[model samples]
Structure formats: structure tokens, C-alpha cells
Target chain A: MARRGDELMEFSGSISTLEELHALSLMVHEVASDWGISEKVLFEVSLIVEEFCSNSVKYGGIPVGVGIKLADSVITIMITDSGKPFDPTEVAVPDVTLPLEERKAGGLGIHFVNHFADTIVYSRENGRNILKIEKKI
Target chain B: MLINTSQKENLQIVSIEGRLDSLTAPELELWIRDNLASPEFDVVMDFSNLDYISSAGLRVMLNLSKAAARYSRKFSVCQAQDHIREVFEISGFDSFIPLCDSLDDVLAL
Candidate 1:
């Protein structure tokens, strides 16, 4: 695992590979458990991490990394990828009220991220995509 | 994830006992397609043991519900944990998929 900052704990698996999603899930579970995160908050944290990481892995065009940090009852998830400059925060929230026939498959992940995260910030700098998500525990 | 399959009153009862994410969703989808393709029987997923599910898992549920419509067979879910139910509600899955209290209850729907 690569430690990117003083506070952020980086996960071992590269965040841009589908093979790493399971490792990420398990790692998140263990880390959240250690942090005493409640089941509901843990689910939200996992959803944010898994959804963003998998999206990057699928379409990020290159390897990505994830880092997690907690402070003041708030957990922060940071995902950095050097792939394309996709900004998930800007993805349109899907209409969940649509009937089954009109429901789209892909946008739900982004919608969940939007719903679960208290705040989402996305920025591109020096050829890397940085996304920060915060959820209060 | 462990998926236990059983039969109850013409419904294929699938009880999942683990997290369903991007990695496990495809495998579950494949299993559902392979074994539950028969239109003669309805389907009900038992989620009492399932504690975690992501959008990927929700996507599979949506696909199964859509498949149920295509095949004209009833497909529903039962006994979801609170977090699981929250996911369903937020994603609008609970509205379209018949959520039951138990396997025996699925027969009533």
C-alpha cells in the first residue's frame, strides 16, 4: 500500500483494475470496522469507494489509486487516476422514478455516490483525476 | 458470497449470505441466467443473510426484475436488511420488485 499523505491511508490494490474491486471491498470493510464506523455509515463509505473505483477501473484508461481518511466524525475518500479527465460529480443524477423499461443501468452508481456522499469535489491537475468524497459518520 | 438455492411452492428461493459488489454481481447474474431461465417458475431472492450490496448488485436485481417481465414470471425479494432495504428504496428497486417478509410470504405475492 502506498501512503500518499499524512492522513490518508492508501489501499493496496490498484483502483483501476476490476480484479482489485474485491480486495478494495474487503479492505474497506476491515478499515471501516477498525474505525468503529456504524453499519449504515460503513455501507455508504463502501458504496462511495466501490462505485468510484470501479468506474475508474472500467473507463479511467489507466491505473488509479484510492486513499481514505477520517477526521471529526467524517470519513473522506480520495481517488486519483491518471486516465481520462472524467468528473463523476458532474454526472447527471438518473431519474430513479422511471419504470423498469426506461431505467438505465450505468448512471445509478453515480446517483448513489451523489446520494450517499455529503459532499463531492472533483478536480483535474497535472494529468491526474482527483476526486474527494466526504460522508459524516 | 454464498448463494443457497431451494424450492418453495414453485418459486426458486435463492438465499445470499455475503456482500454483492461488482466482482460478485456478474457471477450471480450468470448463475441466475443459467439456472433460473425457466419461465415456468417464479423467483424470490432471500436476503436475510445479505448485509451489503452496491449499485452493481442493484443492477443485477434490476436486470432480474426486467427479465421477470420478459418471461412473464414473478420475481421478488424478501427479508432484506435495513441497509439493503435503504439501497433498494433509494434506487427505486423496492417499488418494482415485490419485497416479501419471508419465503412463505413470497407465495402470497
Candidate 2:
């Protein structure tokens, strides 16, 4: 963990496998717990990390870098991957109101991320796909 | 994650323990396909011991629910922790998958 400024505490690393995603989940949980964040926020953060990191490893076909920063009442998650230039924000949100038979499982992860995160932004920079998400605690 | 399966009357009670994310979702999918391949599709997934789940797990459950519907079989989930339940609700899974308060409730259904 590194202190970026007077109020920001940051943790960043690269993960290459699904097992590393689990480790990342544990690390984020421990850090959030140590910071005394609420369990609800912790759950959201855990799911967010899992969804993003797994998507990167499964689809990006390259090592993914994750950065988590906690400052005051907000937590920011940033994911960068060198695999492809895909922007999740451009995808359409699934129709969650559809009945079971008509529902499709694809895109729900990104939908959940969009719902849970207070704000999200995506961009391609220097051949890396970057996604930044923020949530208020 | 660990899956413990047992026969309960007409239902196959599956108790899942630990996290269900992208890494373990495939295992659950394979287990469902292999173990629950029978024509009798009445199944109850007991989530009392499950600590966490991600969208991957939700997708698996959705597929299971759809499979049961296609076969005209019963499927339900019971005893989900509050956080887990919230995940289901957030994703609108509770709308289609019958959520039971207890194993007996699912068995009775």
C-alpha cells in the first residue's frame, strides 16, 4: 500500500490468473476491513474486483493491473489490461426485468458493475484498456 | 468451493460452501451437468454456508433455473445469507428463482 496524498491510501498490483483474482479479493477485503469500511461496501467492492479482474483474465488474454484507492468517503477501482481495446461502458445494459426464459447471462457482470459503481469511465491509452470505477462508502 | 450433495425425497439438495466466482463457476456448472443429469430435476441449492458469490455464480444459477424450467422440474434456493440474498435481488434473480426461507420450505414446494 502506498499513500498518494494526505488522504488517499492506494494498493496496486498485476494479476495473471484466476487464482490471483481470489488473492486480490482477499487483499481488498483485508484492506477494507482494516480501514473499518462497512460490510455492505466490502461486499460490493469484492464483487466488483472479482467481476473486473476475471473479465480481464478470461477475455483480455494478458496480465491485468489493478489499483484500489480509498480516500475519505469514496473508494476508487482502476483496472488496466494490455490485451484488447474493449470499453465495457459502451455495451448496452441488460434488460433485467425480462423473465427467466428470455434472459441471457452474458453482460450481467458489466451491468452489475454499472449499477454498483457511483461512476465509471473507460479509455484506451498506450495500447492498454483502462477502466476506472468509483463508489461512495 | 465445496459442494455436498444429498438426496432429500424428490429433491437433490446441494449445499455449497466458500466463494463462487469466475474461478469456481465452471466447477459448479460441471457438477450440475454431471450430477443432476437425471430426468428428475427437482433441486434445492442450500446457500446457508456460502460465504460469497459473483456474477459468474449468478449466471450458473440462471442457467440451472432455465434448465429446470425447460425440463418442467422444480428449482429453488434456500437459506441465503443477507449479503448473498442482496446479490440475487440486485440482479433480479429473485424474480424468477424461487427463494425459500428454509430447506423444508423448498421440500414442501
Most accurate candidate by TM-score: 2
Residue-level lDDT of model 2, residues A23-73, one tens digit each, is 888888887787768877888888887888898898895789998888767
Which prediction has the highest DockQ against the true structure? 1
Q: In lDDT terms, which candidate is top?
A: 2
Task: Give the Å shift of residue B107 in candidate 1.
Answer: 1.3
Error of 1 at A114 (Å): 0.9
* Model 1 CA RMSD to the hidden true structure, in angstroms: 3.2
Any runs in candidate 1 off by more than 4 Å, and if so which?
A1-13
- Show the colliding residue pairs in model 1: none
> What lDDT does candidate 1 reach at residue B103?
78
Error of 1 at A94 (Å): 1.5
Candidate 2: segments with Cα more than 4 A from true spot: A1-8, B39-41
Worst 10 residues of 2 chain A by lDDT: A1-10
The TM-score, computed over Cα atoms with residue i paired to residue i, of candidate 1 is 0.91
